[model samples]
Target: MIRYGILSTASIVGRFIAGIKESQAGEVYAIASRTVAKAKEAALQYDIKNYYGSYEELYEDENIDVIYIPTVNGLHYRDCQNALLHHKHVIVEKPFTLTSIEAQKLFDLAKQNQCFLMEAQKCVFLPTTLQLKKLIEQNVIGDIRYIELKAGFPGRFDYDHWMYDLSMGGGALYGSATYTIELMQFLFDNPHFQIDGSCIKCPTGSDEICNFQLKMNHQILVSSTIAMNVPLKNEAVFYGDKGYIVIPNYWKSNHLDIYFHNGETKHYDFPYQSEFVYEINHIHECLKQQLLTSPIMTPARTMEATHLVETLYQKWQEDTNE
Candidate 1:
C-alpha cells in the first residue's frame, strides 16, 4: 500500500483521511502540524500511525512514499518544494500556486526529483463531470456557445483567517474560483482561455468578489462570478444551441441534468461515499503505472487555471489603481 503523509490538521484533512482509508491503494500513515499537540490530536482522531511537530520532520521520514498537503494558500509552493526535495510524491490542494510561475517551478522541481506531483483538482476526475464531458463531446448539448459559473456564501468570513489576507494568497479568486476556473479548462479539453473583461470587488484586504468574462480562441464564451457574503446560485450552467446543462455545486458535482429544446429533461447521477475517493484512486492508478504526472490533471492544466485567475487578480489591482 502507498504510505501517505498528511500535512496540517485542517478540517478538510479529516475528509481526505477518510477517503484514503476507503481506497485500497493508500493509507494515511503519517501526519504533521505546527504543534505536536495538534498533530497528536489529529493522529488520535484519525488513527494515524505517526505524527510530527513540523512538516520538515515528516518529510524526512523514509517510510512516507507520498505527501498530501492541505496547508495554507500561501505556503503550498514552499511546502511542496520541500517535500519534492525529499523525494516524496506530492498531491497539494488546489489553486496549486498563487502564480503560474510558481506552479511551473514546482513541476520542474518534481521532474528534477523524479517524483509524482499533482495538484488536487478532484472535479476533473469526478464521475458526474466525466459523464458531462462525454455528453458534450457527443453533442447532447449541441454547440455550447456560453458557460456560466456562479458561487458564494451568505455570511462574512473572519478577517483574521489566512483566507482573508491577500499577502497569503487569500481571496475568493484563489480559494473558491479555483474550482470553476480549472473545471472549465478540463471540460473544454484544455483550450487556451483569454480574459475579455473583469469586475472585481475588494471590500476587505482581499478580493471579496470577482467576475470574469472569458473567451476560448474557438469563440466559446465563458462567464464566471465568485463572491463572499453573497447568496447567488452556487451552480454551473452551459448554454448550447439545442439545450442547456446544469450542475448544482459544480465543483463537487454528484449529478447533473440537461434540458432539451424538445422539452425533455435528462438526468445523470453518480452516487459516492467520499467525493475525494475518485481523485485518490486516480492517483493510485497513475502510481501503479509509474507515471509522475496525472494525465487528467496535468501540470499545464493547473498552470492555465493559475494563469487565468492571476490575470483576473491583476485586473482587480488595475481597477484599484484607477
Candidate 2:
C-alpha cells in the first residue's frame, strides 16, 4: 500500500482521511502540523500512526510515498514545491496555485523530480461527471452552444477566517469558483477560453461576488456567476439545438437529466460515494503506473483554469482602482 503523509491539520483533512479509509490503494500513515501538540491531537483523533510538528520532517521521511496538502490557498504552491523537492508525490487541493506562473513552476519541478502531481479536483473524477462527459461526447445534446452555471452560498464566515483575507488568496473566485471554471473546461474539452465579466470585492479586498461570460473556440458561450454574499441556485445546464442537460448541484451531483426537444426526458442516477474516493483511487492508479501527470486533470488544464481566475481578478482590480 502507498503510505500517505498529510501536510496540515485543517478541517478538510478529516473528510479526506475518511476517504482514505474507504480506499484500498492507500493509507494515512502520518500527519504534520505547525505544533507537536496539534499534530498529536490530529493523529489521535484520526487514528493515524505517526505525527510530526514540522512539515519538513514529514518530507524527510523515506516511507511516505505521497504527500496530501490541504493548506490555505496562498500556501499551496510553496508546500507542493517542498514536497516535490523531497521527491514525494503530491496531491494538492484545488485552485492549484494563486497564479498560472506558480502552477507552471510546480509542474516543472514535479517533472524534474520524477514525481506524480495532481490537483485534488474530485468533481472531474466523479461517476456522474464522467457519465456527463460521455453523453456530451456522444452528442446527446446535439452540438453544444451555451452553458449556464451558478454556485454560491451566503457569507457567514468569521472576520478573521482566511476566506476574508485577500493576501492569503482568499476569495470566492479562488474558492468555489475553482469548481465552476474546471467544470466548464472539462465539459467543453477546451481550456483555452476567455473571460469577460466583473466582480464585487468585500472591504478586506477579497471578492464576494463575480459574474462572467466565457467564450470558447467554436464560439460556445458560457455564463457563470459565483458569489459568497448571496445564495443562488447551484446547477450547471448545457443548452444545445436538440435539447438541454441539467446537473443539479453539479459539483457533487449524483444524478443528471437529459431533455430532448421532442419532450423526452431521461434520468440517470449513479451510485453515491464520497467524492474523494474516485480521485484518491485515480491518484493511486497513476502512482502505480509511474505516471507523472493525470490524464483527466492535466497540468496544462490546471494552468488554464488558474490563468482564467487571474484574468478575472485583474479585471476586478482594474475596476476597483477606477
Candidate 3:
C-alpha cells in the first residue's frame, strides 16, 4: 500500500485525508503542520500514525511515498519543490503556481528527481465531468461555440489569513478562476486558449477579482469570472450550435443537464460525495503504473492553465492602468 503524508493542517487537507482513507488504496501515515500541537491534534483526530512540527521533518520520514501539499496558492511552488527534493511524489493544491515559469521549473525538478508531481485539480475527476467529456467526444453537442463559467464565494478576508495576502498569491483570480479554466480545458479538448479581453482588479490593490474572455484557436469564445467578496453561486454553461449543456456545481457537480435544439434535455449523474475521492483514486492508479503525471491532469495542462491565468492578470493590470 502507498503510504502518504499530508504536508498541512489546512482545511483542504482534511477532505484529501478522508479521501485517502475512503479509497483504501493508500493510508494517511503522517500529517505535518507549522506547530507540533496542530500536527499531533490532526494525527490523533484522523488516526494517522505520524505527525511533524515542520514539513521538513515529514519529508525526511523514509516511509512516506507521497506527500499532499495543500498549502495556500503562493506556497505551492516552493512547497512542491521541497517535497520532490526529498524524493516523495508531490500533489500540491491548485492554482498550481504563481507563474507559468515557476510551474515549468517545478516540472523540471520533478523530472530530474524521477518523482510524480501533479496539481490537485479535483473537478476534472468528477463523474459528471467525465460524462460531459464523453458526450462531447460523441458529438452530442454538435459543435462547441461558447462557454460561460462563474465561480465565487464571499470570503471573510482576514489580513492575517493566507487568502488575503497578495504575496501569498491570494486572489479570486488565481484561487477560484482556476475551476473555470480547468473546465474549459477539459471541454475543449484542451485547446490552445488565448485571452481576448478581461476586466480585473486588486480592488484593495493587493488581491484581484477578474472578469475575462478567452478565444480559442477554433474561434470558440469563453467568458469567466472569479470573485472572493461575494456569495457562492457557481455554474458553467456550454453552448454548442445544436445544443447546450449546464453544469450546476462545476467544481463538484454530481449532475449535469444537456439540452438539445429539439427541446429535449437529458440528465447525467455520478457517484456523489462531498470530497475528492476520485482524484485520489486516479493518483493511486498512476502510481501503480509508474506514471509521473496523470494523463487526465497532466503537468502540461497545469502549465497551460497557469499561463492563461497569468495572461488574464496582465490584461487586468493594463485595463486598470488605462
Q: Which lDDT tens digits does candidate 2 get at residues 1-322? A: 9899999999889988887888877899999999999999999999999999999999999999999999999999999999999999999998899999999999999999999999999888888999999998999889988999998878567657898887788888888777877887787676467778877778888888888888888478888888888889999999989999999888888899999999999999986647688888888889888999999888878888888888888877888789
**Pairs clashing in candidate 2?**
none
Best by TM-score: 1
lDDT of 3 by residue, 1-322 (tens): 9999999898777788878878888898899999999999998988888899999998899999999988878888888999899999999888899899999999999989999999888888888888888888888888888888887777567556767676788777777777877877776678877775444444455544567787887688888877776664588888888899999878988899999999999987776554589999999999999998889888888898888878867766676689
**C-alpha TM-score for every candidate:** 0.96, 0.95, 0.93
Give one digit per residue, the lDDT tens place, for model 1 in 137-209: 9998799899999988746567777877887888887887778767877887777777744555455668777
* lDDT score for candidate 2 against the true structure: 0.88
Better by lDDT, candidate 3 or 2: 2
- Those runs of model 3 whose alpha carbons end farther than 4 Å from true positions after fitting are 200-203, 318-322
Q: Give the range where candidate 3 is weakest over 10 consecutive residues by summed lDDT.
A: 199-208
TM-score ranking, high to low:
1, 2, 3
lDDT of 1: 0.87
- Model 1 alpha-carbon drift over 4 Å, by segment: 196-200
